[model samples]
Target chain A: MWPGPADPVQDLIDNFADLDSLVRVYPLLLQGFGLTILLSIVTLPIATASGLAVAVAYSTAGTGVRRMLVVAIDILRAFPVLVLLVLIFYGLPFLGLRLNAFAAAVLAIALNNTGYFGEIFRAGIEAVPPGQGEAAAALGLHRMRVLIHVILPQAIRKVTAPLASNALELVKTTSIASLVSLPELLRSARVAQEQTYNPTPLVAASLLFFALLWPFARWVARLERRALATGH
Target chain B: MDRIAENYFNGAVIAAALPAVLRGFGITVLVSLSTIVVGISAGLGLALLRCAAIRPLDIAIAIYVDLFRTLPQLVILVFLYFGMPYLGVTLSPFVTVVLGLGAVLAAFSAEIIWSAILALPPGQWDAARALGLRPVPLLFLVVLPQAVRLATPLITNRAIAITKGTALGTAVSLPETLGSAQSAMAIMANPSPLTLAAALYLLFFIPLVALSRVLERRVARAG
Candidate 1:
């Protein structure tokens, strides 16, 4: 006998056979994916630049300032990015400064990421030999020039693996923007699933995410292995 | 200022929402602890399998870890919560979140433990083999103890990060800390509940962050 409607296998086939359903939702999901990519692209440079500034300040500051900066970074690291997003998106309006959902999400994610990137950059900077800076200075190079020519390039290379991994994380994290009603990939899939009463769109979205992120993940893993092998 | 305080920082609103948020926090703790247990055990099992170096299983696990590692936890949760019903495997929201997050934690922990195992000097393995110890006993007795020590700091840090992910349960309407606070905010039309939730999050996570630091320092000193 052919499988009937009550058969679980039949139901599963029916559930997944909704290719038309998936096709309908594809554009929405694509737009959402575009937004996710955009958010990540925008967030990375901002977070990294601010993080570099913080790391530099922390390294060069007086002991009192360094202590305070350390505390601030620790607090920011401890704070959940979701809570940060919520506080900024929902709570900041209380302070008479309202931001749209996109702006709020970007600000919160960037702030949280800056804390992580700052710590990473600081470690990278420390990994460079202090002698390099002194040697450059002794060569009659200005302090700023020494930092620019001798320190940052090495530090950036050292931190590339962590930074790339963080960037991938930020990409995945764009899903969280759905909570604030930003029409990112997850939100689009959810909307489609609700409208169609089928899970095919969600599956499509998962595949889309995997397709987008897998290569980058592999690249980061490769970089990390190389870095580790080089004793960096 | 008075109007601002009345609308956004109302003490009464926060007080009224405190119980709900605390209840949600209790759920968060429960979910995190339970997932930690599941994740670490699964991770240990996977690491042992990986140590055996069977080509097929290793490849399978590598794929599994890669999939979980790269995919967003939110997507996984959505799939399990919404997609599984088609397969005739419906789970409660709590189970869905736990399973989703636990899978991620397991992948990370497995990697940490496997690397720790690799970092063990080759002599240790050879010495155990010479002692006429079989693979199972040798692994259980010699390698794992040292690997566990090496893996502890990283495992703890990863565990805290994953536990913080319990907040994402809100996306699935799990009524965890963030979810409950969101509902309270909706009902009260004030952000006081969210503020309270933020304070609670800080209170909970700050200590864990501090502890992770201490552990990291100790590990560095030991090395």
Candidate 2:
């Protein structure tokens, strides 16, 4: 099914002969990978909070805020993350101050994630029993306090796997960091590809991505099974 | 940044890219539409396969769905772009993009449509069969309509996903909205209308998807 790359199997061996060069770029790649994790971690919290808030606003509030949030969420959800990334990353500098590549990437992703997270949180919170909210209200708890102490905890558990899955998507999406001259995994691979004149580095970097993502994918799978079994 | 603005919307370049981008958008629409067509049919077939009593077919669809679901869209795009060209097989950017989108969406779409199918209680299928509803009209007239109605909201989400995934066509230089903008910016050395280009993308997508959601809710409610 494939042609021999000289020396029979040795061509396969030789294709990746530049593996050692990755050692130098490894730290750089690790930094990029670290930044990806940082992006996801940073996004996970802020988006979760805001998404819950947005969801709450819509679920409870009048037509004005609900309609605004609906339109906002719809637009953000429909647009590709990269498109927004380009807009935010480049658009912000035009406004005066500028974030570095990593900050911009993180911010762009976080902004995109916030809409999604908001919907997820909204759904999770909505899944909570109405009686629970009523009880919390009956206890003289403020809406904010009730949300914080009563509703959010259970909703958080309901939405954990989804948020984690979104985190996994963030891992792959972070690969776009290469475009912005970020020293992420994909960018290092591109650099190594140029330096060694081989595709091995790119493949290695992809493998690195897969290695990073597989655990989360598996975890999500397990969580899905649990959710199913529990009849969530 | 200042110099980049000078060439932002060069009439000549935008004109050159316009035909190409329009053609690319056509291809995008074609791909998205075809993916919907093929993905829906194939997805439904797979869903039916899993629902069938035979373990072999059920197992086969399960693995097929799993394999396609687990693979990344980028990998599939790269493979179709780079891999098939070597085997005396060539495809236009249009076909490749459509096929790639179809391949990715089919797996998830199948499961989504299947869940919708499952939601109807097994009694529906039994009821159809008991009424002497054979496969064709039973599916075309009876089952799929209801399933489609049930799946409307989720399908809208898939529609948005498919549209976003089509942006990947820019990678192969198909001159879609993003590709034209990249070329425009690259030649002009200006990134201003990259803003405009981004705006145009949001312009194209935001309303289209919003309307689709409205349609989804309407269908969902009607169903």
* Candidate with the greatest TM-score versus the true structure: 1
lDDT of 2 at A151: 90
Q: State the lDDT at A62 in candidate 1.
A: 96
lDDT of 1 by residue, B45-136 (tens): 99999988999999999999889888998899989988998787998989999999999999878877887787788999999999999999
User: Which candidate number would show the highest DockQ if scored against the true structure?
Assistant: 1
Candidate 2 per-residue lDDT, tens place, A100-174, comes to: 877777777667777777766776776788999999899899998898899989888977866676666665666
Predicted chain A of candidate 1: TM-score: 0.94
In the range B77-135, model 2's lDDT, one tens digit per residue, is: 65466445434367777778777778667776776677666566677778889999987
Worst 10 residues of 1 chain A by lDDT: A223-232
Interface RMSD, prediction 1: 2.3
Each candidate's interface RMSD, rounded to one decimal?
2.3, 4.9
- Model 2 clashing residue pairs (backbone): A51-A118, B4-B190
lDDT of 2 at A211: 72
Judged by whole-model lDDT over C-alpha atoms, candidate 1 comes out at 0.85
Model 2 TM-score, all chains together = 0.76
CA displacement after TM-score superposition, residue A56 of candidate 1 (Å): 1.1
Model 2 residue A143 distance off true place after TM-score fit, in angstroms: 2.3
Candidate 2 residues lying further than 4 Å off, grouped into runs, are: A1-35, A57-62, A94-97, A124-131, A154-165, A192-208, A218-232, B1-28, B51-61, B82-92, B118-120, B124-147, B211-223
